[model samples]
Target: MVSFKFIHTADLHLDSQFKGISGLSDGIRSFLRESTFTSLDRLVELAVSEQVDFMVISGDVYDAQDSSLQAQLRFYEALDRLGKHGIGVYVIHGNHDPLDSPRMKTGKREHVHVFGPEFEQVTAYRRQDQRAAAVIGGISYPTAKVIENTSLRFQRDKDNSLFHIALLHANIDGDPAHETYSPCTQQDLIASGYDYWALGHIHKRQILHELPHIVYPGNIQGRSIRETGVKGCYVVQVAEDGGVNMRFHDLDTVRWFHETIPIDSIAGEEAFQTQVEERMQEISRECPGKMSIVRFVLTGRGSLHEKLEEGRIAVELLHELHRRAIRSASEPSGLAGLVWVESFDVRSGPWIDREALLKEDSFLGELLRYGQQAREDMTTRAEVLRSALNPLMANRELRMLLNETDDEECAGWLRRAEEMAVLLLAGEGGGESTDED
Candidate 1:
C-alpha cells in the first residue's frame, strides 16, 4: 500500500477587482485588492508547514483570463517557494483562466505540472525516491465556455495499484448560483473510479460525497459580501489501505459576514441602536486580527419599527455605524479598519396593535381591516398586479424606464403604503393602545 499526502485548493482568483461591492473607503479598497495575494502567501506558508507531498490547485488560478503581471509574479513566487521544499504542484486552468488566456513569461517553473486543454493524466512524484505517488487526471477549459461534461473524459487504469485523484474546475449538478462550466453529476464522478475528486469553481466549501472522497475547498479569500464567511483550503492524507483523512485550513486575510438582528426584544430607539452596536462588536470580536466586511439585516416587530419606517432613519443609522467603525479603526490599538457595513436593511413590521385598531369604528379601523385582508391575500393580489403590469412592461421603452417587479417587492410596497396611511390618519401617537400607553 502506498501512502501519500497533498493539499487540494482552488479558485485562487488572484487580484480580484471586487466590482460587486462599492462605496468603500480607499483603505478598504486597497486591502481588498491585495487580499488574494495575501491569501496565496498564507497558502504557501501552510503547505510548507504541513510538509505535504504536493498541492493541486483545481482551477481559476487568476481572477481574470488576462491576469495582471503582479498577480502572475506573486503566484510564481509562491510556486517557486514550494519547489524549494521539493513539493510538487498540479494545476488546471478554470473558465476564468483558460488555455488561450495570456500567461506571464516566468520561464521554466520547476516541480510545477499543469494539465492542458484536454483530459489527461499526470503523476505527483515522491521526493526521496522519485516514485509515482498518485495518478492525477484533469483537464483545462479551452476558452472559458466549457459546455460539455469534462469529467466524463477522465479515465483511470483499474489495473494500476497506485492511488488515483481527479481534479476539475466544474459545476457539479449545475449549481444554480454558478455558471454551468465543465458541468457533470455525482454519478459521473463515481463512475470514473477515482479515489478522490478535488473540485473548484463554486466559492462555497462543502463535501459532496465520501468513500471516494469528493471535496470543494472553495476560494482562498472573500471578494464580496455574497461570498461571505470562512474561505480556505484542505489537506488530505491517503493511508496505506486507501483510506482518506482530510482537514481544512484558513487562508483568508480578511473575511466577509452577514448578520441579522431581530428587533422584537428592543423596547425603543435607544435599545435598538444599542443592539446594532453590540452586534457589530460581537462580529468584530469573532474576527479579531482580520478585517470584517459585514452586511446587516434588521427584522421582526418592535417599538423602533415605526421609527425605522422613515426613509432617512435607516440611512442615518448606517452613516452613524460607519463613523463608529472609522473611530474603532483609528483608536489607540492602531490597527487598520476592523469592521465595515456593506449595507443595512430594515425589514421589520410595524409595532401596532391590530386587534385594538380593528375594534374602532373610524376610518383607521376600516383601513387596518383592509390592510389585514391584503396581507392575507398577498399572493393573489401580487399576481393580479403583475398580470396588469406585464403588458405595459412588454413595451421596450417602458421596460427601460421601469424595473421588473417580483412578488416580494410588490408585497413590501403594499405593506409600506398601509403603514404610511395609518401614520397619517392616526396622528402623532399613531392611535397607540399598547399596555404602557
Candidate 2:
C-alpha cells in the first residue's frame, strides 16, 4: 500500500439551467446561469492547491441528456488543466448523463478516463514515486433508467495490496427523494469489500459508514431552492497503514439559504424593517465571497400580518429588499459579496387570542374547532384534504414541479389555510368582537 490523496466529487451538473426561479434582472439571470461553471472552476482550483494524486467524479458531469459541445469542451479543458498538474481524472456517468445519450465530440485528452456502460477497473499512480496508489472499480449507466442494481455487478480487480475504491451513482436503498435508479443497499456495498465508496445521486452530503468509509460528497452546486445550503466535495488522504481521512471543501460559487423571521412580538413597521436589515447584513458575512440566494419566510403572529397581505406590504417589502441587494451588488464591494433576495413568503397570522376564539359560540368558533380536530387526525384527514384541494393539486403545472403531498405537509397547509381564513375573511364589523371573531 502507498500513501495517496485525491478529491472525490459528484454531480457537477455543468451548465445547469435553474427551474422555479424567476423575476430576475437580465444581469442577475446571467450570473445565476454561470454559477455552475464558476463552481467547477473552483473545484479544479481546490484540487490543484491540495496536490491530489487523482480526482474521482462519480456521476452526472453534465446537466442535460445531450451535452452541448461547449460544455464538453469546457469539461475536457478542465481535465487538461489537471493533466498539466500531473493529476489523473476518473469519471462516471449517472442517469442524467448516461453513456447512451448523444454527445458532441471533444478532443480526448490522456489524463481523463471516462468509464463505459460496463464495470471497469482502473489504477491511480503517484506522480513523484511512480508507485501504485489505489485500484478503482466503477461502472456507468447505459441509459437514463437502469432498473438493475449496478453495484452487484462490480467485480473488484483482485488486487488487495493497494487501496480499493468503488465509484457509483445510485439511489441507496431506494431513497424516495430521488429516482430509484441503480438501487442498492449498504449491506451490498460493505460486502463488496472496497476500502472506500465514492457515491453520487443524492445532493445532501452524508456518511453512511466509517469502518470502510462509504460516503456521498453531494453535488458541487445546488440548482434549486429544494437543494439548499453550502455544496461541495471531499478531499481524502490515505496513509501507509491504510487509514482513510476525508474532509469537505466548500466549492459552491453561489449558495442557497431559507431563513425564517419570527415577528410575533414586534408591533411597529419600523422595527420590522430594522430586523430584516440586520438579518440581511448578518447573512452577507456567512459566505463572504459568494452570492447568496435567500427566501425569507415571515412566521409567527403579529400586527405586521394584518398589513402583509391586505395592503400588499409583503410584496412591497420584498421589492425594497431586492433594490437594496441590487445596489450593494453593483457597488465596488463586488456582486459575489451581495445577497440576492429570491422570494418573501408571508406565513405569519394576525394577532388573535386563540383561547377566546375557541370559547365563543359563533359559527367561526365552530369552524375553528373542526379545523383543529381534522388537523389532529392527520392519518385520516390527509386524503380528505387532498381531495378538497384536488383542483389545485390537479393543476398540470403544479404536478410538474411538486410531488404528491405527504401527511405532514398536508397538515401544515391545512393549518396555514385555517389561520388565513380567520384573518382575511372576518369582516371589519367582526373585528370589533375580538381580533376578528
Candidate 3:
C-alpha cells in the first residue's frame, strides 16, 4: 500500500492583458496588472506549505506567443522555489503557448519536467521515501494548430501498484467560445484507464467525472469580465486503496462578479442608492477577503428609470461606491468590504405596467405595438438600421463593432428602445419624466 499527494492546476495565462476593463483608477489598474503574478506566487506558497510530492500544470503557462520575458522569469523563479524544497513540477503547453511559440523560454531548473509534443511519461517520487509514487503521462502542442485527438495517444502504466495520471490541454468537446484544439471526448479519456485525469484549456472549473476523478482546475486568475468568480486549482490525495480525494483552493488575487438587482420596488434617488449599497454589502459577505470588480445591472420597471437615464446619477453613484469600497478595504472593522463597481447598467423600464399600456388605444399603445413588431422582424429592422448606420460605418472602429449583429443582440436593442419610448411617453403625460432636456 502506498499514498501520495499532488496539486493540479492549469491555464496560468501569465502576463495576459486584462481586456474590456477601462477608465479604472490607477491604483485598481496596477492591482489588476500584477494580480496574475501574485496568484502564481500564492500557488507556490501553498505547494511549499503543504509539501506536496509534485505539482501538475496542464497547459497555457504563458498567455500569448509574445509573452514578456518578465513573466517567464517570474514563472521560473517560482519553480526554483519549489525545486529547493525537493518538489517536482509537470508542465505542458496549450494552444496559447505552444512549443514553437517564439516567446516560450526553456527551463533552466532540474526539478521542472516539461512534456514534449508527443505522449510521454514521467515518474514522481514520494518525499518520505524516494520511491516511485505515481506515473504521469502528457503531451504538448507542437504548434498552435493542433486539432488531433491527443487523448488516444495516452496509455496507462501496466503496474497496478502505482497511481496513474493523465494531463491534457484540449477542448473535451466543441465549445463555441473556445477554439477546438486537441479535441477529445469524455469516452476517450475514460477508456485510458488512468486513476485521475487533469484537464486544461477551459477557464471554468468543472468536474466532468467522479468514478476515476476527471477534473478541470480552471485558470489561476480571471483575465477579463467574462472570466468571473473564484478562479483556482485542486489539491488531490491518492490513498493506498486507490481512493481519490480532491479539494479546491482559490488562488485569484482579484475576483470578477456580475449581479443584477431589481429596482422596481424602490422610489426616490436616495432609496435607489441605499439599495445599491445593500447589494454591495451582500457581495462583500459572499466574497470575503478578496477585492471584487463587479458589474451591476439594474432591472425591472420603475419610476427611478427616468432619473437613472437622465442625470449623472449612475456616474456619481459608481464613484461613491468605489469610495465605499476603498474605505471598506482600509477599515479595521471589516463591516463592509472592498467591492468596486466596474460598470453600472440600467436595464429598468418605465413605471407604467406594460401590459396595461398595450390595451389602451392611445399613441403610447401604438408606439409599443410598433416596437414589438420590429423586435419580431429583426431582419427588416436590421436593414432599416443598416441604412441609417451606413454613413457612420465609414469609421472603421464603429463598423468593426457592428460586424456581427447577432439575433439575440438585435432583440436586446429593440427591447431597450421600446423601454425608452415608453419612458418618453410617460414623461409627456406629466408622469414625472427626468430627462435632462
Candidate 4:
C-alpha cells in the first residue's frame, strides 16, 4: 500500500495586524505582519522533514484587501522552496482571495497549480511500480460574494473510479454568524462522490466527516482576537487501500490564548496577584509554545467587584499582569516560548450595590438594574449590539461599518435610540420631565 501525506491549510491572512482596540507598537506591528509567514516557513520545514507528498493551501493566503507585493513575493519564494524538493502545491482562492482579484499574485512556481475561478477538475497521478493512482476535482470562489451553493459541483465526483477529493471554501453552517460564503450545507458534502473534501474560510480547525472524508484545516494563523488559540494546519494521509488518516500541527509564531482567571474567592491585590500568576503558569503549562500572547480575562462574581470598581486597582492589575509576563520572559520558567501579553480583559460586575439600587423608584437603582440586565442578557454591551444589529448588518457595508466602529459609535446609536424613546414618551403626555422622572 502506497501511503502519502499532504498538508492542508488556509486563511493565512498574512501582513495583517491584530485588530486590537489599543494602538499596536512597532514590535507588535512587525510581529503581526511577519508571524504568519514565519509559521508558513515552519510548516514548509515540517512538511519537508515529514516527507509530505504534496501540500494543499485551501484559501485566504493574505488579508482581503491588504495583500502586498512583498507578501506575494515571499509566498512565491516559500512555494518555490517546496517545489525544489519535488513537493507539489495545490491551491484554490478563498473568499478573501477570489480568482478575479488583480491584487492577488501567484509567483513563478511551475510545481504549484492553483485552481481558477470555475469549478475545475484535475487528476493527481502517482506512478509507482508501473501502476498509476489518481485523485481528481477542485473548486474555487469566482467572486467576492458567492450566494449560490458551490458544493453541487462536488456531488458527481463521489462515485468516481479514481480516488476523488475536493478543495472548497465556504461557511458551512459551522459559523452561522459569519458571512454566508458559498452558503453550503453539510448534507451536500456527504452526498458528493468525493472521498475527501478540503475546506477553508473558517479560521477555527474542525473535522466534519470521516466516512467520505471532509475536513477544514482552519486558518494558518490567527490574525486577531476573533481568531484565537493554537492556529495551524492539517496533515492528511491517503493509502493505496483507500484508508485515510488526518492530524493537525500548530504553526503559529505567537499563540493567541484566552484565559479566564476566576476572581470568585480571591481577596486583596496580593492574593489576586498570586492567583493571576498561578493562572499564567497554568496557561504556560497547557500551551507550551513560543511567544504566547495572552488575553487574561478576570471573570466570575467575588470581592473583586469593589477592587475592580476602583480605577486605580484596575490599572494596577493590568500593570501586574505585564510585570509577571516580563518576569516570566526574563527567567527560564515554564513559559517556554511565551513572549507577550497582547492585552488583558476584566469582565467584572458589581454583585452588591447601594440600597438605593434595589428600590424600583430610585433613578440610580434603575440605571444599575438596566446595566445589570444588559450584562445578564448578553456577556457584554458589544455582544448585545452585535446581536441586535446582526440582521441589519447582514449587508456587507453595514457589517464593515460595525466592525470598524467602536464603543463611541455604538454610544451614538444608543443615544439616538434613547432620543426616540423620549419622544415617544412625550407623545404619550406622561407629563414627567426626564430630569424629575
Q: Per model, how many backbone clashes are there?
A: 0, 0, 0, 6
In the range 201-306, model 4's lDDT, one tens digit per residue, is 8777888878787788777777666677878888877887879888888898777777787777777778876876676667666667656666766666576655
Worst 10 residues of 2 by lDDT: 428-437
Please identify model 2 stretches exceeding 4 Å from their true place: 155-159, 352-382, 392-395, 401-412, 424-437
Q: Write the per-residue lDDT of candidate 2 for residues 1-437, one digit (tens) a residue.
A: 88999999999888878755766776777887788888889888999999998999999999664376767778878888899999999999999998877787667777788898888888889867778999988999988998888888765556468899999999897777788989899988988888899999999999999878889989998887778988999999999999988899998878888889998987777887788777778888887888888777888988788777574766777788777777766677767667777776677787777677777776667667878788778554766675776776678888654465445456667767877778854544332345553
**What residue runs in model 3 are displaced by over 4 Å at the alpha carbon?**
104-107, 158-161, 285-288, 323-336, 352-396, 399-415, 421-437
lDDT of 4 at 352: 38
Structural similarity to truth (TM-score) of each candidate:
0.83, 0.88, 0.83, 0.78
Error of 1 at 179 (Å): 1.0
Quick one: best TM-score, which candidate? 2
RMSD of 3: 5.4
The total of clashing pairs for model 2 equals 0
Off by over 4 Å in 4: 21-25, 104-108, 127-132, 157-159, 285-289, 320-336, 351-437
Give me candidate 3's TM-score against the actual structure: 0.83
